[model samples]
Target: MVKFEYAPAPESTAVVDIAPSYGLFVDGAFVDPADGEPFKTVNPATEEVLCEVVAGGPADVDRAVQAARRAQDGVWSRLPGRERGKYLFRIARIMQERARELAVLETLDNGKPIRESRDVDVPLAAAHFFYHAGWADKLSYAGFGPDPKPYGVAGQVIPWNFPLLMLAWKVAPALACGNTVVLKPAETTPLTALLFAEICQQADLPPGVVNIVTGAGETGRALVEHDGVDKVAFTGSTEVGKAIARSVAGTRKRATLELGGKAANVVFEDAPIDQAVEGIVNGIFFNQGHVCCAGSRLLLQESVADEVLDSLKRRLGMLRVGDPLDKNTDVGAINSAAQLARIRELSDIGEAEGAQRWSPACELPDRGYWFPPTLFTGVSQAHRIAREEVFGPVLSVLTFRTPAEAVEKANNTPYGLSAGVWTEKGSRILWMADKLKAGVVWANTFNRFDPTSPFGGYKESGWGREGGRHGLEAYLHG
Candidate 1:
């Protein structure tokens, strides 16, 4: 075989100017945390130190929540909905203008391919703001009754996988509904959130309308547990989601959680094989499979299981897995060492439990966290890899004897976040969509997200939707 190599086409790092250190963004300004520890945020792709970020504590969370409360009770609450919408419009425009810079910074901090950060994450974030901006003055007609009111203060905690986008998902809707927010970006990817704080400043948004607190679980716990906050929004692991649910058990506080998923991608025999293969590759490999709605379980009809597996393996071999900055790269570095270790642990268990582990021949960079696009065949529903959320570039392949069996296997897991159905038969697609327990089902596609669509999960996948008109309800009271 003749090998072909392409020239390096890496994105320029000069586009994003990272500061040596950053502070918490509270009350619309960047300030040093009071008696708080500082931690380093690194580039997962290179294990290089990106910047020092403050680790907010209970007191810091209190300060942020107080600021948000003050804003919600004063300036923001008094502002007209049209005026509030104008501010969001300005933020959205600023985000669009600085999209490239934010995209580069996100890729640096998040270790996702620059292609995704640029094309998907950043744009969708801006779109979210744009979409919600129009709803600010129109909430009365959103079918939430004539006088839907904003929840006073929202304590939002976002995951690192899609930092800015998740921030937009939580913050945009809250602000549009006239709520003030104290947002905590995930510890590993706090830089972009801080940058977004700067965007809020540029938009001249009211002081304390949006506050950014950078920290680990303790800071998040304090914020959510604070009595001052009227609403809580979180996107992360299901275990933590359950913890948040329990923490707010007796409180009057309302919470919305978008949690983990073990989505099943069902491919029927009548489907378009090539497109199905592409969707399968994209579902598990996109964002290094850090997505909450990743199609990690491959459920192929028994008659075509072998053919689909062969195509999937061959396609995986051609995937470019290296520097995330490379324009040609298809798969990028794993988000962090801890996530990579977890993926490895689950994969090892899969092998030990009589499943066949297979990965393409791809060279990983020596200095950074990396995992090849992997698949496990002969995997039963009982296997740990098949049951748990790996949150990495891993897929578990299972054969299904019929449509009923596929639905049964798909709904067997505890997660109900998302699923994919690939079939040319419209009736089968409709039937599968109705039967699957997941919140979002993609027919012949996978991982398609839109700001206009309501996205969330059922059962253990968490409560409430994060997009479209339905998202506003979480931040409002009738």
Candidate 2:
């Protein structure tokens, strides 16, 4: 018999010593907001005041843009691509060194399970830097012109879900390609990104190479509309993505949007039943189904629908949901009150729209914002649950008589960021992969991501890839 010892989840007693106020990062140092207004970032899980961060209005945005513009016109853009690659390499190494601390902060601020922050989120963030670092100097061979230039200054806005990882995705490649960045992390989860600002300083990255301005939608609007920025990258909702597209239309600022998704994980009759059950759990319940590419819809072959559903419910029943810091916890609190409301409203709509709703029989914590892992059966293509991005631990189950119907119903949504096909048949897997309209399709798996693989969507899911060689293109100008 083999024995394994598990380490207890680490705890942080050091009070989050966010100064009475945090200022915007400009020219490699923290400074007051140009507009002189500030906002407090709160811990959604406990509704506690985490810190007061700078609320950058138009003036602050202008200053941040000016800083970025200067860096692009001066040292950062002038640095050799190989040297830029070295900077990214150092950031990646530091990210690994600080993974545990970042994971704790992530769980505290964003209310996601620490296991995911430590195991999935932090590691992949570093991997993204590692993966893109190699491409900094090899841009000429990446299908672009032999001498691709950097987009002057990238104005980036990222969502609260996976805060640090989004920062890595947006900033790493921009830095690797020699473009300075003005990044606005989502208001609710600004802690990690602000900490990342500290890491930039520790790595000795050039001032203005990366800047963090923390605020709400208005902050994002200022950054996007700033004429000095050359490109804009946003990751959030479909409605917001379209609005951004319209906002930047006819402007010199090129934009890429990685928006919402209602991905389908299809289980054919031949799928490994046990494996499919686990995949289904991970697809929808992982991160409390806050994932944009969550398998919100489960398209099971009619023959095995009952069997798969039974097994899935059984597996879901065993999941532990509680404190995010507990390594054994499988799910965590909803990121915010607004997100919880949205999930509840949509789940209510699912029931009103005549789909049968089911949740595991578990006693949820009375304090933090929480939702039980939920599923809807008898869902039709016309139901709101089937069409809308619930973006919670909610799954809609529908059956298909044939593979064509599976693909049809899977791609029926306006968004198509990702999808999954589960089957033992090699030909069926390939055929399904070819027919699916999503940007990422997993065969015999669901919700698996690698830094080296490209990720994004086909339609309303948004444009441009996030990882891999293709990600570098977003920062380069012809």
Candidate 3:
């Protein structure tokens, strides 16, 4: 068991130069927005203003897009594969050296627990860069013809949940495939990505290879719809993803989306109850359930529901909830006020739809957005909680009698992004793995990710993979 050290929570300060309220990173340098409009980015835990970030309007995105075009035309696209690989290796090394600072920045900007930002997000982000760098010179083995070429100026829009990690997932492969990039981080969580621009400069990467534009939905639309961009990669709500799909339709733009999911984590009677309970907790509440592939549904065998719930509830009660920077905190504040309301509205819908609701007995922060770890029992396949992606630390519990029933319940949702199975029987694990339609399946373990693994949905979850050799194809075309 990992013992979380309790430390005194620190107060918020507005004037710390430790992190910058950055502008758009254009041509290896930070530049002010063309419109001169700036927005304040706040620390969600205390609602303290962290920095005044420049909001990229259409003109700023055009500048960024044009810069990316120039970089792709002049340098990155024509660079030798080995040289590109070396740049990625340098960035990966820099990421590892500065991992701690990036983690704190991610937690401060995105409102996830510090432990996750440190242990999961930062390391995985670096690993992604390392893994993809190895593939730069070996694109011939990637099964996409003998000679694959980079798609110039990829316009990638990533989510607030895993800012730095998602940036690596998108940027690493694009760089590996020899594409310049103009990425827009989520409005709520753009700090770590902006900080990454400094890492690029430190690595001595050429100008316009990466540009970070910070703003809301309108900014994302401006980027994707812009003619200068050759490809669009997005990770966010399904509604917005579909809108992007429609916007890019009839155009020659290459697009890929890693959207929302309502993943099910099944615990069988033969499973280790304690371990499964912990996996369940980690799966759903790791980032306060702000994950796209979060195991929001729990399908327990009828014979062991009581024992599993007992173990789960006991474990839930012991979780520390407070300031994100506190190492002891298991549950942190919601990313934004909008997300908190969505969680609340969904939980209320679960209750109104006749599902029993339960939350961990814990106090939330007095300021900023907060929601306790929640669970809903009596959730049928028809329940709103079962069907909808309540992207919060809320779990929906359902029961099943047989393996067939378990698979049936697990595959009931439109999303096939991810699923988890906990069982002592090896045969059952294999059987369930074949049956589940999710892009990624976890047998016993949940929410585990590696840089070399392929991750994407099979159905409405979206098309294409984000890691492994397959991830390179999205940015490549001969």
Question: Can you give the TM-score per candidate against the true fold?
Answer: 0.99, 0.97, 0.96
Query: lDDT of candidate 2 vs native?
Result: 0.88
Stretches of candidate 2 off by over 4 Å are 1-10, 13-20
Clashing pairs in 2: none
Q: By TM-score, who's the top model here?
A: 1
182-265 per-residue lDDT for model 1 (tens digits): 999999999889999999999999899999989999989989899898999999999999999999999999999999999999
Q: Which lDDT tens digits does candidate 3 get at residues 1-478?
A: 3435566764332322454456789888998889736888888988988888877999999999999999999998888889999999999999999887888888888888888888999999999888888998999889998998888889999999889999999999999998999999988888888889999999999999999888988899999999988999999888998999999999999999998898989999999998999899999999999999999999999999998998888888888988888776778889998888999998999999999888866777689999998888988889888999989989999999999999988998899999999999999899999999899999999989988888999677988899987788899997
Please give the ranking of all candidate structures by TM-score, highest first, separated by commas.
1, 2, 3
lDDT at 242, model 1: 98
RMSD of 2: 2.5
Query: Comparing 1 and 3 by TM-score, which wins?
Result: 1
Which window of 10 residues has the lowest lDDT sum in candidate 1?
A: 1-10
